[model samples]
Target chain A: LEKEIAAKDQRAHEQQKFYPDLSGEIAGAVSKRSEPNLDRDFDTLDEPVWVTVKRDLNTVGAKFGLVLFPTQGNQSLLRNWDLWGPLFICVFISLLLHSSEGKMGPHFTEVFTLTFFGACIVTLNIKLLGGTISFFQSLCVLGYCLLPPGAAAVLCKVLTFASEQSSLLFVIRLLVTSVGFVWATYASMAFLAGAQPPRRKALAIYPIFLFYFVISWMIISHSH
Target chain B: MTDLEFQSFHNQVVTNVQPIRDDDGGTTYEFQHSGDIDRVKLLDSENGTNSTPQGNKNLWSFEYYQQFFDVDTDQVMGRLLNSMVPRLKTNFIAQHIHPIPDLYGPFWICVTLIFTTGICGNLAKYIETAGSTINGHFESDFHLVTGAASAIFSYVTLVPFGLYSLLWYRKSEVQYTYLEILSAYGYSLTVFVPVSILWVIQLESVRWALIVVAVCMSGFVLAFSFWPAVRGDKKLIAFGTIVGILGLHAILAIGFKEFFFDAALQSNKFGADNADFSSGALDKALTDPAPNAALTLNDSQSKNAKGAEPKAASNKADDKESSKATANGAPVATADGGGQKDAAKV
Candidate 1:
């Protein structure tokens, strides 16, 4: 019995020595890196073939928007999606507008010319810039929705039952959604909202933005 | 410059520099030491009149990063990211990161080189058309600030350093994407937009605020980028990415529509050609005139000296107790300021 006890003690001692403590005494070393981290490590270091798999899985999870509370678990890129999504949406809106402008050629050439030229003037006057906005986010979002205009709801259902019902059909559906949103915003602005003189409209918007900025600045200044 | 100054100055630059801090603590900037040092004389004597930089923006030193860090493992992708990260310093910013003072004098030199090219290149033409006149007075001094921001570094500084940083990034835990960096570059430009206005407005209050804000935003990215965990830290980054993307969209959508209007503002004041020029050209034009403006002012002063009664008359006046001297000789300086209009002569 004593011999068996001694053997167990030896094993414990070696395990304890896995790491050193402040006093250089042997300390317990925890094994098991919580599987996700393990997967992440593999994903980052794995060969190209496996990388694609990891990337797709990650993107798919991102596509769902967010199932796992991004904050609680890992520091994955998806957590910031709330704010990111809006930025992406803005880009999409711009592209939609650009394409619509493209469609109105031949007869509406003058209108198109006026619209584009007017935009450039407004950009510089009020210090309109490119950094606070970009095209990448919108592209990514569109991809998530399975290309633009379809809003193809090819819901990437991990669950077998959901996949059986709508995955294939949704692929096309996303495209439709994009088309619908584009038309809605453009048609509303063009046909519904009567055309205001470009310069005057710009002048109007600048003040409005300035007013908002000033008020916010004031409120913030006063609060502090 | 001494290491102390380099360190203190670095505190200023990192807040304003690119590739911000790798982790939150602070950024590691590399200062590449070039042999050339501006021999500045502190004293004002016959021999003390050594060369200080002609303008405040002249570079005192320059250096580039020794290396950029990136993931180097060839292991399977999963194992590499997951496994390699464990070995990273809990302080994931490179352990041997260079301090700013070490980087700055070198950085300033590099910046100076870049600014020179940028100032001299096509950009200068455009800035001149922006109207040398604002409220009837041309701002000859504006280039003292904006010109510095736009310069393209000397080839020596721009090339090897550029390659070094790229190589460094390739070797680090996270390989930076050109697109990602470029977008960040764009955002940096936007954040910095307000600070550049300091030259235009010259308000200590507004300028300081913008400078502080610009510095904060500028360093936030690269400094944060150093850690895989931070880069991997999806929460803030993803949110930021999303916001940034959305912002891009909003800006482009609005910007395209807004561009024409902005350009139109220059018409009556600047003329048609000014709008056609790239912003770089405009910036250069503004700076190019500045050097000449100073020279003409000096020339005009010499003429005034000749036109004024000879020094003998002033001496005679002093001798007769009729000498008149003001508290300052500022009239001569005003002549210099006025000489901006004479810049067309250049």
Candidate 2:
């Protein structure tokens, strides 16, 4: 009877120790469930490929939206750098800039080299100026910010295809391209301007200005 | 490979105080120590930022190309300023860019010139036609960017390549690597950037004067810089190279004037009038050098009538119309008049 009583007591002690451990595990799991970063890592093998692609596409679209409507409150683009948006924007712009019938525009390779290399050089310039941004982050911001000019290029291409070449059309193109140039420069500066040293802001901004200026020039001049 | 070969030849001719053939292998031991020290110093001086030994690296490595771009802003600015002063005695390759030829000045200078030429060319066109009756609506012609790129790139690349080959073929007294010559040629084009911007003033006299000044400044730099490279060659060869260099320089300036700035303006003004005229007659009319009555007619008619076959196809009707338009005024054909003579011929 004493042995029986002692065994019960020992079992009670083990159960008490396990109770605290179980409670701690429950608390840990609750905290992990509430963590915001849980969705960032997903098992690709557990889900369908389409799900992965769809989620990736959603992320890219959200990035594009951020670039399009850049506000001071949202700057997640530089924090999580991705090349998908940049690649798409670059290829689309290059494809649009390629020479079409009767109009002599920049070749595809020319546009590609200009965009990729131009971004690389500009990023290098920023780094040389002691910018706080990472190389890819600056690149992502620059590439994504090209959306405005890309939109302008699209509008110009449509205008060229829709109507005859006239001074009025040209004026419209100039206005559209100027807007795109200004918006692109401003947006990129908004994202990347802080990365540069305060005193050398102008130096960093100048290259960005020239970079977009060249692209804007291509847009305004090429479609006609 | 060519760099290695040229380096060997260059070392044999210029840096070798002792003419010992390695086949004998007797003085090779003596050459090794000095050569190593010289190489270390050269590598150090080439890029103080990254003093990686470049001698053993393959050409395909990124580090090989980095050496060519190892210039600071101050160095580039100094090199750019030095390129503008066209003195006969300044050996650009020897003094400015010696063993280490930087590509930063050449690359950026060429790019700057390309944009300047493209933008300024359009500006000149706009200024020329600003006062016309064509509504003066400004449209940026993007073709100029492509055209300027081709012209300037071909000129910079091909000219240096040709000169390098010529020098290599002749086995010239001073061995100049292709990059050194390319660097010299590229920097010499820096004077054109501002000159191109100044071309927006639509005055022929001013244009000509600008071209002369630019060509002289840039041409003298090229001629004087290259003279030493070819000096040890035959007299005819050396003078011929200099003359060729100057001629090409002048041609490029004139080409910029004629092709980009002048030709388009004339074509826009006289395109309709010259539609039906014979090719020779059109040429004659273009060269008439007269401030004729077609100015007022073109102003009114070409406003919306560009490529209007109904108007251009009927030459007789156009002539009567031109005569009526000219009789109304003192013929304010004060500038760039070409269509009236062509219309009269048709």
Candidate 3:
């Protein structure tokens, strides 16, 4: 009986090696039967593109979840880095923050390229400051860290709808964006702080400060 | 013996072949060595850039952008010098930055200009406001950095893109890539880097002089460099394009001076105008010149509040007072609107 059970576990492990269940094997055999076979031989070349995109999005979403609570193991973001989250967050923020009739805000493309260029500059600063992290990894971490600011932008948008432009509203925007700036900086530092030498950590952190500061300023200055 | 050897060769060929059953229960004869090699090659071709194929690089990959930043220090310095001294014969983009334009120069030049403009504009403001009682306390406005970034970045990118599109539309003799146009525009702004630093000198005449010098230096470089691209088009349109280019360049320099360095004077004018509107002086002036019959009802109400005087004089003072309430209320609303505009400007 024990031998039979061991054989069943072996088969399950081998099957898992072939087919990855990103949602987890939580539902036992029911969900296993429902998952489409994405892991096939390359010679076939017949898998629909959406299946791969769905899988990648799942991974990206998981990383976004990790960014929310940047604890000790959040460094796993560097292990398998991707830019989709950043791109999505940037587009989200830019779209929300774009200029309209009376609301003079940053244009769409300005905010979009600003994200890429800002990421590039911040990554270069990290490399120059002697951080051991790879280029794209720094970009990935910085991009994912934009989640807080993106959220702040959304919150400010909602806040704008509720009231007229006044000092009180400005104060609220300041408070909200400051929280976002601090959160973004803290989360990114949590993920990246270990990569720098002890002496050069502050040097590496200053650009990150400016990067988030500029973003937060944009968020706060978002007026109607 | 020949018959026996031929029969043996046929038998050997049959014996070496084997039928293998695939997952779909189809049996196929395979030459094992060649099949493995073909399968590996098929996978390689299918995987594409994962195996490092040269010339066809994935555009979104990091290595693709590395080429733009491959420029050395000497190349950047050469491009900087080339941008400042406009040589009519030399096509700067084609002659200097070719094969691949270095983005490092443009990116860093814009960055340097943002900081210099922001810091110098603040310094200019400090000097202007040092003795003023109105704005006694001075806090450095960091919004200038954000404003400068957006303005400088959008100008650098959008202007070149528009020009490239226009050239493409005209079917010009020269085919300039967007990046090449962008590089030219970026280098053109290099003159402003030093000029912006000089704007801190607090002399309006000197500031305007720097603006003229910087605009002419960079504008000529832009005009001369871009002339070849526009040369083949119709004569009027071509000249118009160059004029438009210089006009836009002049606008940017003048805007930087007015908006950033000369902000105090403009704001002071707005404040004085707002004050005059609120204080009923403008209202008195308006009511004195034209006393419309509709205002007399409002006039009598104010006359009762201020005690007796001559009927016409009372009517006029009352007109001023009543108009003052309405006019003052209007300016306050406008003041709110103006404040919002100022915030938007920031």
Q: Count the backbone clashes (under 3 Å) in each candidate.
A: 100, 1, 0
- Kindly report which residue stretches of model 1 are placed more than 4 angstroms away from their true locations once superposed: A1-64, A67-69, A75-224, B1-194, B197-264, B268-272, B277-346
Indicate which candidate wins on TM-score: 2
Docking class of 1: incorrect
lDDT of 1 at B25: 33
Model 2 off-target regions past 4 Å?
A1-41, A46-54, A65-79, A91-100, A103-139, A151-179, A186-208, A222-224, B1-54, B134-140, B269-346
lDDT of each: 0.29, 0.68, 0.68
RMSD of each: 27.9, 18.8, 18.0
Tens-place lDDT digits, model 2, residues A1-224? 22234445566556654643465333343344345444423234677778778877888899888888888667888877788898999999999888754433567887888898899998976775567888999999999999999999999999988998777887999999999999998889889987865666765677789899988877776655
What tens-digit string does per-residue lDDT give for candidate 3 at B1-346?
9879655433333333222212223222333433565577669878875656463556886566756665544566789999999766787888887676867678767887897887787667666766575656444555567868877997798678777877887888998998889988998899999999999987878987897678768887887777788887776567656665665566567657756776645444454333223223323322331222112113332332233223324343444356544543453334234323322232
Query: How do the predictions measure up, each by TM-score?
Result: 0.21, 0.60, 0.48
The candidate with the higher TM-score, 2 or 3, is: 2
Worst 10 residues of 2 chain B by lDDT: B335-344
Order the numbered candidates by TM-score, best leading.
Answer: 2, 3, 1
DockQ of each: 0.01, 0.08, 0.04
Q: Which residue pairs show backbone clashes in model 2?
A: A221-B142
TM-score computed on alpha carbons, candidate 2: 0.60
Instruction: Please tell me which model should have the higher lDDT, number 1 or number 3.
Output: 3
**What 10-residue stretch in candidate 1 chain B is worst by lDDT?**
B33-42
Regions of model 3 farther than 4 Å from truth: A1-120, A124-133, A136-224, B1-34, B37-55, B133-135, B272-346
